[model samples]
Structure formats: structure tokens, C-alpha cells
Target: MIDYQSGYILRPVNQVFIYFSLFCALMLNLLPIDNYSWVPDWLIICIVFWNIHQHRHVSVILAFGLGLLMDVHNSELLGLHGFSYSLVAYLAISWHRRILPLGLLTQALHLLPLFLMVSLFPVLTHWILSGEMYWSALSAALQALIEALLWPLATVILLAPQRRPIHVDHNRPI
Candidate 1:
């Protein structure tokens, strides 16, 4: 079992797995079910995870591109998700050095603010621009809560493939 404490090194994440997770997030958003108010944004979560864990492979530009697809997915104004996702990517990249050192629950709690902002950005902008709210305040809050809770779960599942196996080998030293 991999240690949850500090100083435990994870194997390098595969680039293909990173892209696959992002793709799956997009597909989840594209499912035929009607978009619900409380559903968490899988794309945002995945983007944040990869941004924090593998910043070099996943950058702000890619987040913007993914956001564009999300914009189309939700039938929202163009560049809304793009801008928000780009902001998320930028923020995650900026805070990654700090976030990587923290424990799972702490990391999730720290992300709550960012989750709120990403969930509310478009709603706030829409209200400002057209004097209407696309997302109700309660729903946004719920979504943020769900995403925050999912952070720890997402971290574990996404990092599973990258975890190093524990073995007793005196001759081999890390």
C-alpha cells in the first residue's frame, strides 16, 4: 500500500491516461440525460487534477480548448466555460506547488473557493450581462459542494495507475 503521508513518491503518470480521463469527463458531460442543476462539473475536476499533478502535459490553453467543447455541450454562451476553465487551469498551475504537499482532505477543502468561482462565474456574468441568472444560487452551491467532496475521490482514482508498488528489496534503493 502506498503511504498517504509526505515523502511517498508516485510513479510518473502516463500521458495517455491523462488524456483519456479528460476525454471521459467530456463524454460524461455529453450523456443523453438532461443536464441537472446539482451535477458536478467533471471536466473542471479532471482539469484541476491534471493541472495540479501534471502541469506540463495539461496547460491553460488545453483547458480553454476543453472549455470550448463544454460551452457547446451545455449550450451556454461561447467562451464562458473556456474562460472559467482557463482560469481554473491557471490557478491550479499556480497553486500546484503548494497543493501537492498537502493531505487529501486538506487539498479538497482548499479547492472549495476555486470550485465556487468556476461554478458561479458564468452565472454571475450572465446576470450582469442580461439581468438574469442561468444557475440558481442554491444549485451552484450544491454543485460546488459536490465537486469539493469529489476531489478526494477523484485524486485517489486518478492517481491509482501512478501509484508505486511497495516491495522489499534490499539491493534496490529508491
Candidate 2:
């Protein structure tokens, strides 16, 4: 086993894992949730995971890239989601070292509000840019609530490290 003191280097395996995780996050973001979709912002959730675990390597740049990709894929205003995500990434990375040491459940709880703020900011921007806010505030509030409730479970699933195969020889050990 590699020492935990391995610092923050992104090994080749880690790079692959991070990029794969980002792709999965993008797909999840594209998945159509109904009008009252309970699903949270998957890309933000993924960003939080990466920020917590790999702060040194994956910073705001990755968040901006992912957000820009999302904007293109969804045909959103060029920098709407990108700007919001970049701010969130900056905040998450700022506290990452302190935050990651907390228990997973606690970390998720603390992160919930921050995620909501990030999501809501974009919605408000979209409203302003379009010159009319049509969505129901009550409904958005409810969705944010649901997202907060779902965060802990999602955090665990996202942050769980991939298990590597172990070699064993039954005959060698008397």
C-alpha cells in the first residue's frame, strides 16, 4: 500500500479516475429530470467530490472546463453555469483541507447550503438574462431541499475509492 503521506500528486490512475468521474457527472447533468425533478446538480456534486479529495490537482480550472462543456451541451448562456461553478469550486477548494478531515456525513451537511447557493445563483442569473423569471420560487425551494436531503448518500457514493484487486496464494502461506 502506498503511504498516506503520498501528498497531493495525481497519479496516472487518479487522473483517469477524475476524468471518468467528470464524464459520468456530465451525463448525469444531461439526464432529464421531470419538471419537479428531485435530482440535484450532478456536476456541482461531482465538483464537490473532486474538491474534497483532490484539491491540489483538480481546482477551479477543471470546474470551469466542465461548466463550459455543460453550457455548450445544454445551450445555456456561455458563462452562466461556468461562472457559478467556478465560484463554487473556489469556495470548496479554499476549505478543502479543513473540510475533508471532517466525517463524511458532516461534510455533506455543511456542503448542502453551499451547493444550493451555487445552484440558485445560476437560476437567478438565467432569469435576469432572459428578462423574466418564470419559474416558481416555491418549487425551486423544494428541489433545493430535496437536493440537500440527498447529498449525504451521494457524497458517500461519489467519494468511495475504487477497490483494487489483491493477489493471494493459498498454497504459499502454511
Candidate 3:
């Protein structure tokens, strides 16, 4: 079990895990999906997980930085994703104590629309700013649908309890 002492930064291994997860999310975001990308935003999902699990350790500022990096990588309007992600992070952090203790199914169900709402706000902003009201609202709705569906799986996989290691004498090997 990891002992997170008060105000202690994450251990090296944990830091690496966080960085790796974020990097994977970035790669997923950058994946070429042709003209129509059906993928949900992986980084947001990871951010949600981290904030839920360790809000004290990770803050809205981290989410903002990641979101800004994502926008720069994708060449989207600067600060757009940053603002949206920071908002989401704040929501998650504020609700962390309440939400993190719930059962997985309940948590997922509860957070589905919350995630959708966060995602939709940015999309709406993007659409209005770009003056490209071309895509129907259904398109954004569908993306949120996919994201909602994936959230439970993401939480389970990322936060699943790992088996503990056992000690055995080498001489006892069969």
C-alpha cells in the first residue's frame, strides 16, 4: 500500500505512471481518424480519474496545462481546451470526496452527464467561435455518448486494485 504523507509529492513510479497515462492520451488524441473521428477524448478521461482519486495531489492547474498542450498539439484555438478542462477539473475536485467513495457503477452513471456537459460546453464554444454551425448537435451528442460509455471501463482499468506480491524462499522452489 502506498502511504501518501501529508504534502508529499507523488513517488517516482507514480509520477511516471501519471506521465505515461497522459502521454498515451495525447497519442490517442492525435491518432488520424480521417475526416470523421469517433474517438472520445482520452486525456479528459484520465484527468477525471486522477482528479477523482487524488484531487489534493492534482489540481485544476495541471488539467489546464495538459489541456493547453493538447490544444497546441491539435492547433485548436488557444486556451479553449484549457478553459474547458480546468472547469471540469474544478468540478471533479469539488465533488471528489462525494463521488470517489461511491460504487463504480453508481459513480459512472452519475458522472456520465457531468462529463458530457463539460465536453459539450467546449464544443459549443468551438462551433460558435469558428462560425461553423455546419455539424448538427447530434454529432456532439454522439461523441458525448461514446465518452459516457467509455468512462466506466476507463475507471475500472485505471484504478483497479492490484494483487499483492508474496514472499517465498528461493530454496523452496519445486
Candidate 4:
């Protein structure tokens, strides 16, 4: 169990698990799902989850690096995902303390705007550059909606190890 009064202390192994999860999410995001491809923003979801729960471990630089990698993988305009993800990381870290005390549903509600910002920033940038709004922006909004709906499940899966009961050797000397 975590010592809440002293703050959560993550072991080295836990840190590796978190990064490994993010890698898996990146691979999952790269899958070819046809029209349903936009249904899940796996990388953004993972980044947001970690930033909120373990902000000290997940930094905005890491988020920006992952976003750059995502842009390369998707053949998108470079720096688009980087900027959006960094923004999401910043917002998540900013609001984490307030959101931490809320129920899962309420937390998801609060994150909706952040997720929308993450999804729409690239589209808005493109519109500004081209002077035309693409209908594809609607898909980003739908993706945000899906992500918000799935936030609770993501939290449960990602944070499960942290919530596990720790075995203390009481016989050991203090």
C-alpha cells in the first residue's frame, strides 16, 4: 500500500512499467484500423493518464518526443502532435491535484476539454495555414468524445499496479 501522507513513492520497476505501457500504446496507435482508426488516441490517452497520476515521472519533454515520433509515423505535419501533446501534458499537470480527488466520471468530464484541445490543435493549425476548414476536424471531436468515455478504464488499467497492496517485512529492523 502507498503511504499517502508521505506521498506516492514509485519503485524503479514501476517506472519501467509506465514507459512500457506508453510504448505499447504507441504501437497500438499505429495499427491500421481503417475508418475506426481515429476511434482511439492511444498515445494521448496514456500520456494524459501518466501526467495526471505521476506527473513527476512523465515530463512534457517526453510527451513532446513521443508526439514527434507519432507525427513521423502518421506522416503528419511535423511538430503538430508535439505541440498538442506538450500542451496536454501541461494542462494535465496543472489540474492534476484538483482532478485527483474527483470520482472517475467527474474526472473524465473535467478532462474532456483537455482531450478536445489535444485533438483539435492540429486541425486548427492546418486551417490557419491553408485558410480552409476540413470536415475531418469533426472526426477529431468524435475521437475526443471516445477518449473521454474510455478515460476511467484507462486509469484502472494503467494505475492498477500502484494500487496493489505492498508487503512489508515487519520483522526487519527499522
How many steric overlaps are in each model, in order?
A: 0, 0, 0, 1
Tens-digit per-residue lDDT, 56-162, candidate 4? 99999999999999899878899999999999999999998888877888999999999999888888988999999988665888888899999989987876676
By TM-score, the better pick of 1 and 3 is: 1
lDDT top scorer: 1
Error of 4 at 132 (Å): 1.5
- Provide the overall lDDT of each model, using Cα atoms, as 2-decimal numbers: 0.87, 0.69, 0.70, 0.84
Q: What TM-scores do the predictions have?
A: 0.91, 0.74, 0.76, 0.85
lDDT of 3 by residue, 52-162 (tens): 776766789989998898778768789988988898889888887777556666777777776787567756886788887655544666666677678778865664433
Best by TM-score: 1
Spell out the clash pairs found in candidate 4. 1-166
Instruction: Give residue 46's lDDT in candidate 3 (0 to 100).
Output: 85
Write one digit per residue (lDDT tens) for candidate 1, span 94-123: 998888778989999999998998988887
Comparing 1 with 3 on lDDT, the higher-scoring candidate is 1
* Model 2 / residue 134 / CA error / Å: 2.8
